[model samples]
Target: MMHGLAETTTGALTLEHIGRRFGETLALDDVSFSIRHGEIICLVGQSGCGKSSLLRIIAGVDTADSGRVLLGKTEVAGPDRFVEPEERNIGFVFQDYALFPHLTVEENVAFGLKKLPRHEARERAAAVIARIGIETLARRYPHMLSGGEQQRVALARALAPKPRILLMDEPFSNLDRGLRERVREETTATLRALGTTVIMVTHDPEEALSAGDRVVLMQKGRIVQIATGYEIYDRPNSLYAAEFFCPLNKLPGVYRNGRVETALGAFPAGLNLPEGGQALACIRPQAFRLAQPGEGMSARVVRCSFLGEIEQLAIKVEGVEGTLHMRTTERIEVKPGDDVRLVIEPGGVLAFPQA
Candidate 1:
């Protein structure tokens, strides 16, 4: 509720060899990571990738099958002990908001502060509601408010108790596109202002890249990579990690010297591979740009589609099977069966060992 209520640097969290299982399925496989006192990290992956399960384990709602979780040197979930969710001082905002339809916004926010006196809880709720600029919605019920309003109320309720660590499970998935962006920006700013330690799970790659200070990418119940958004996007550790952030155009070739030699052209092998070993060049659509007819790789435009701010071109290049897609904002006057030359842009290509 206050500007610096969560400013204390006492809520550092660490997870060591954490594992979870649902019957025969392995949900999390030796997952491990840590969070700073007031840092914001985003957990991103495909559905059932154990992102939500990991969050539940950290929140003490679900038990870890193996390993331990430490919050400021205290083991919250481990072999020797297990702390209940209420005692962990962790706040969770579920995917659906989970606001009670029967209660008004004010009452819902005050719900978490029941430990305080009734009057004091109401006062705290009011202050948070006003702080989020949602005072007018205090008396309105959940069913009467828009999706964005409900999301704000959910965030207010979570922040009401000033929990040491806040876990949000797809908190912005329910809002429309424009509103989701606006609310995400506002919520991120609010949380940063409060200096709250946050772990937010998101399925959207763009959201994860833009919102998080660092992105933790998980796959098949294991962490594939953990790095800042830019590092993860530009320097992915594996082919899976590269494909996760964006659709990639894979060019099969052989690694020679420091480049992968394909029929079309040679591209820098970002990763190390044995000489003459098979390598796959993972190039994003934006990496292919239009060049003068004879200056770059020769290609024929198969199709072009206007997509609002940008245009998508499906082009055919010699020695490359199928059509390679390219996206650009330039207004290229091209159509099906048109001749074109394309150049590979620097820094948009990632090389990996061919599977």
Candidate 2:
């Protein structure tokens, strides 16, 4: 299990059999993953899924009851030994951009560098401030800055420490949607320029997919899938993995003879299923293409809504229990009760067999 020097650029982090619990709740369960050096990975999951707990464990701020955490070649935490947070070469950015209220922006960024000589600390702070383009606001207090400006100051402070690994906990949650997008892009660029190995925890699936080089998706207390945005979304390991990225149109059926037959059509299971097992043909909303009458399953349009670039339709297919949602860029001429035909895209049908 030796990753070469190229793979261990900044330093590798390996977690083996990490587990944590709080009274009646299992916060983490046998979590294990390896983070490559200089990689910006997202630890993504819903609330209560242990993403934050895992980040804290990696930073050595929290201890795991059972596991081994290795940073570089050094064992930071294990049953035999534990390293304190200060001893771990980790930098952290809290969700609220925790800046010192009373201290000026420059002083706050230089706070961690105080261990060095006074002259060297001041030089490092000035260099980071200039790099972050926040030198204009150096003397200003936290309250004098806007949300975005304060975030920049916080980032400057984190970068000033020159930590081997940076752990960010929902760093953009406080900003509005528009600002979040802009700030996220800015932060990504900054981190890339610095070549810092980062593991960011986020609850937003879209954000995780877009921001991270690799996305580690979690459910309950363990990882469900880990891959790039396209890989996880296009080749999900299960129905749960598929639905997490986008809305799904589920068509239930029985799996047999290597196929799952549904109201729309039959799809290849691609894997063996239990005999007569309950299965679902999961399709994306954008998968449905309009076909001529008599060519495919006939459906009557019950609802249609026009978005800016795409149109959404709710159609009731014959023998189907619920309205099927479809998105298309083609012009829509049909209204309520208008009969239409629909077909599934070859790439869209995913069959998941349930035990």
Candidate 3:
């Protein structure tokens, strides 16, 4: 519907061997990844995992100790060259929405267009404000705007300049959970309509998985994996990557004849572990479904908790120690001490080499 979606330009962003250090801490280590033009990338990791630090380096706010960053064929940062943040044609939306307190929404949006004529800057500001559907707040100052309104204003200001790339660091984190979800949907739609290339940093896995075209998962200053939401969740590269995105029911087992046999069932060992090696079958909570009596592994419902659309369940199976957590969206008619049968839904089972 929007013509802007087809207006993606050339100039893929490429990072080569980027590394940074702070005192004794290695913040970023040889981090290398490429983003296609107009692609939305989300950097996700735990605190101190270098996601934010990598973003700063890409925006030219923080310099890398080694390696180079290339926009298309032009080098932005390297051993021989360094570009200032403003001159890099990159827009940054900080987590706190850094709007000028003394200026109105329109004025704040127009501040970045200082190089243009006064009328032209005002026109661009008004056009961006209208496009983002926040023109009604043009005359209002930051103090008078709500958290969501301020976030919209910040986005409008960032997009006003029509930069080559946009970087956001947890832009929706300040709002309430419901508001955050709404704003995220709105922002994603707006970015897609404008065909803006974006690199967003988020600590929340749901935000990362939902909003990103591709997710970059990092751990301890190193990149763990890079893939689409489905691939990252279903075909994780490591145990850390698997557990980072969702909770897994790790069942201990032994690898034999290309399968890991656990007390629950046998799962294809996706790893290349030697025969008779220690392995684990990682099953997601939603992987278990209700089965008819005596059809699958027998499990006892230890507890059942209603969680709106999805129900959380603690199940106990014979020959396996500890309670296995399960989640289901179906209106399962069960309670504690009820006998139940659970069948493992195909594709939710993954085998990993035990550490």
lDDT of each: 0.90, 0.87, 0.91
User: 132-194 in candidate 3: lDDT tens per residue?
Assistant: 999899999999999999999999999999988899999999999999999999999999899
Task: Name model 1 segments beyond 4 Å from true.
Answer: 1-11
All candidates: CA RMSD in angstroms?
4.3, 3.4, 4.9
Better structure of 1 and 3 per lDDT? 3
Best candidate according to lDDT: 3
In terms of TM-score, how similar is model 1 to the real structure?
A: 0.95
In model 3, which regions exceed 4 Å deviation? 1-10
For 71-124, candidate 1 gives per-residue lDDT tens digits of 877777788788899998898999999999999999999999989999999899
lDDT of 3: 0.91
Ranking by TM-score: 1, 3, 2
* List of clashing residue pairs for candidate 3: none
Model 2: residues with Cα > 4 Å off, grouped in runs? 1-11, 331-334
Summed backbone clashes in each candidate are: 0, 0, 0
Give per-residue CA lDDT, model 2, range 188-225, as digits (tens). 99899999899999999899999999999998889999
Pull out the clashing pairs in model 1.
Answer: none
Clashes by residue pair, model 2: none
